[model samples]
Target: MSRQSIVTAGVLDAALVLLFAAIGRLSHGETLAGLGVTAWPFLGGLIIGWLLLRAWRHPLSVVWTGLGIWIATVAGGLLLRLAGGQGVQLSFAIVTTIVLGIFLLGWRAIAALVRRTSRKRMPAPV
Candidate 1:
């Protein structure tokens, strides 16, 4: 993959985490003052996953990087929230896992499909 694509993958992952945090905060009627706090757990988890995977080199790998980010984000987010005295509801956990999986994995899946289709459409060189 090109350097630009790798960077874009990382940015997309971060953006999705931020989006998830923002939506959750809004849903809970949280004031904007606490937005940073609300976003940090998941973000922290994402960072850890990136580090563990050394993801900067290959951020677009759906199996390694994407799955690692998803698992780390959810597990780390839950653990951190619990440590911070934020109760984790079964329903909330379920929603977070489902939504993050969709957001984190969805883009990569779409990109892969597009690349596959485009490759098929290209004519072979003589």
Candidate 2:
């Protein structure tokens, strides 16, 4: 992948993690002012995922990079939250897994589909 694609994937992953935190906080009647407190664990997990998977090399691979990152983001986030003395209920973990899986992997799936369709539309080489 190009440098730009790698950077974009990383940024988008972070943004999705933040969005997950923000939604959870808002649903609990928490203020946006506490967003950093809510987001940091999952963001940390996202970084860990990127590093562990060397995700930049295949940033858009839905099965490879995306699956590993999603797993890391959920598992690492829950572990970090536990370490930080934050609530880490089973239901919360389940929700986090489902949501982050959707957020991290969903985009890559869409992008893959788009690339496939666009390739089919391109004219044959001379």
Candidate 3:
């Protein structure tokens, strides 16, 4: 619920979307100049995801925020792309889901693991 956590979650999720686009562009030998085209649709979905799920409350929670964003992004992005006459192949959907799942949820999973480890190492409270 803190301001910093909300900001961090937003930044992390947005950066993952950008990273997904940038890395895909690199893999396809496309220039980064086209990142806007690649990133905007997903970013749009990210906005919707946040709004629909009230993700700001727990934006880094894997089950709620992360999964919600992934599903919303894929569905929203496909709709946007379809409206724009852009390609929305099945393969793209599958790839987007897998990659976004990793990027969005992966960090939180790692953080949770680390927190668990740290807690185990701490002495019992007096």
Best by TM-score: 2
Among residues 3 or more apart in sequence or in different chains, the pairs in candidate 3 whose N, CA or C atoms overlap within 3 Å are none
Residue range 1-126, candidate 2, lDDT tens digits: 799999999999999999999999999999999999989989998999999999988999999999999998888888999999998989999999999999999999999999999999999999
Please, what are the lDDT tens digits per residue for candidate 1 over residues 1-126?
A: 788987888889889988988898888898667877877888888888888888887677678778888899899888888888888999999999999999988887888789899999999998
Task: Give the clashing pairs for model 1.
Answer: none
- C-alpha local distance difference test of each model: 0.86, 0.93, 0.86
Poorly placed runs, candidate 2 (over 4 Å): none
User: Who wins the lDDT comparison?
Assistant: 2
Q: Return the candidate ranking by TM-score, descending.
A: 2, 3, 1
Residue 88 in model 1: shift from native, Å?
1.5
Q: How close is candidate 3 to the true structure, as a TM-score?
A: 0.92
Q: What number of backbone clashes does candidate 1 have, counting pairs of residues 3 or more apart or in separate chains?
A: 0
TM-scores for all candidates: the values are 0.89, 0.98, 0.92
